[model samples]
Target: MRIAILAHEQFPDGAKTALGVLRYADDEVVAVLDRDRSGHRVTDFVSDVQDAPIVAGMGDLEDDVDALLIGIAPIGGGFEESWREDVRTALERGCDVVSGLHYFLSEDEEFVELAAENGCELRDVRRPPDDLSVSEGVAADVDAEVILTVGTDCSVGKMTATMKLARDARAAGYDAEVIPTGQTGIMIEGWGIPVDRVVSDFTAGAVEEMILECGDDHDYLFVEGQGSIVHPAYSGVTCGILHGAMPDRLVLCHDAGRQAIGGYESFSLPSIPTYVDLYERLAEPVRDAPVVAGALNTAGLAEPAAREAVDEFAASLDAPATDVIRFGTDEVLETLLSSNPNR
Candidate 1:
């Protein structure tokens, strides 16, 4: 599909969902709607992803788009009032409106009417399935080795690391699959139950369901993780995933030099060692998942600095580590394979 991402003021950095789509989605991105960076090209900011024009609004798009994707998954995942005009414009132009936000665009009367009138779809990727229940501890019984990406904090490259590791594992001749747990992952894989959107009681069940479905087919299941276990607002979701997936191993994800939780500056993050202890301890009762490796996000650092950060991070965790984007996932994948000798 020909797509235009609506990212508003958050372009390259704050728009994690947008960057994921740009890097991994099979759909063609025609334009990026970011008023703050209008007239700039995506290559000007990030050169690796598919290059596209950054336009001020939908009216600036010179080419027709099949869909307009909501690209910013903010702290609360709320839809901004300022973006309503662009959503309306996209629907009026007969383009499908896709959103990954907690705010359901399909539930909005105005958007619903506009989409129906224009014969367009309002696809809410975060919507949970109707028949979800509490997890039954079934994920632990899966035949595959499940490696979950747990994070020091939210948006610290858990999803990205999970995707990269799964890809590299496949390249190395292992049957691997990415079990997406968020909207961006769902969009890329075309299947997953967004645990964050499910009722708190059913969050673990949602994750368990996916693990059971794919476990028999793949030798390795790289479950895309959500939220940090230390994050005050999102910790519940994090715990739910940990208990539900019952993973055999865990890969700790963290942004290099992040001393405090993103957006919650008043609360400082625990040390790397503390985070490792916390995740392992939390998963110990339900499962024996250890933090086997580290996936550090060194995007803010230069190549030399990124490498240094990765080394330092690895030393702290006492495990193999790498900037999966800059360096390949060889070290991490090798560690994963080595950890599961019997598999």
Candidate 2:
């Protein structure tokens, strides 16, 4: 099957390239088209057959070609006419198009119409699930726990959420401390919890070490994946941890930019958005545990536009609090952790 993979945005570039590399390695790459600035392939742009007659874009697919993988990144940035033309061209040529790009992946009216008109079957592969098991002897209780935040695109809030939740618990007069558990060290000033760089064979070992440390000081531990496991920003280590930890409560945090058109689907697997969605998509393969709460954040001081989007999401999903932690404030976080809602 001749497959034409397209990359028009940032997040998908990494994933697209990675996919191409894998396919080529496995001798399945018919051709690769990447518009983003990626340093993976030595050639600026190359075709599969070297110098044979090839189709230009999606408009010219060979008779034997069966599938076309259209990848688009950076959806919130709005769509350009050229991109619309590309989509039109791809569909007009009669190819099976699969995309996990956020913008074109949603069930939006326009995209739905486009898919129908083009006779194209759109399958979104944004969130691929994690296939790892939880570490043994880690599921004891949930109190004064340690939170692990590590990976490619580790959010400051992932660790900060620990602070906010822990603080809220403390205000309710519970014992909790926010600890930084990961292989890498972050610049968390006020989160006065201990820092332990767990050495492991891989990322999974690091997570196990963090949880083991948590067992000593805190009963319950919350570990945040650095990036999207499904998206391109995710790390193999993070997925390993998720599989190995089998955490009691899986709190999936969604960035406000998520609902945007090309949000999560734009990137490759392991991206932050894709990682979170992976948990949502693959139910049994990933984890059987129920998600305690789906946290939402604007990734900053909540601008008016961002605030509006997040508010609507929080209202819809019933998230208790949204981005409630200030940066580098141990006292504030301590207070929040002290108030345990589960208690």
**Model 2: residue 214 alpha-carbon error in angstroms:** 3.3
The count of backbone overlaps in candidate 2 is 57
Q: Measured by TM-score, how close is model 2 to the native structure?
A: 0.42
How big is the positional error of residue 45 in model 1, measured in Å on the Cα after superposition? Answer: 0.3
Off by over 4 Å in 2: 1-156, 182-201, 258-277, 280-287, 299-307, 315-321, 326-343
What C-alpha lDDT does candidate 1 achieve relative to the native structure?
0.92
**Index of the highest-lDDT prediction:** 1
Question: Poorest 10 consecutive residues of model 1 by lDDT?
Answer: 334-343
Candidate RMSDs in Å, in order, are 1.7, 17.8
TM-score of each: 0.95, 0.42
lDDT of 1 by residue, 1-343 (tens): 8999999899998888899999888899999999999999999999678999999999988799999999997667888999999999999999999889889999999999999999999999899889999999889888889999999998899999998899888889998999999999988777888898889999899999999998988788999999999898999999999999999999999999898998899999999999999999999999989998999999999988899999999999999999888898997898897747534
The lDDT values for all models are 0.92, 0.43
Clashing pairs in 1: none
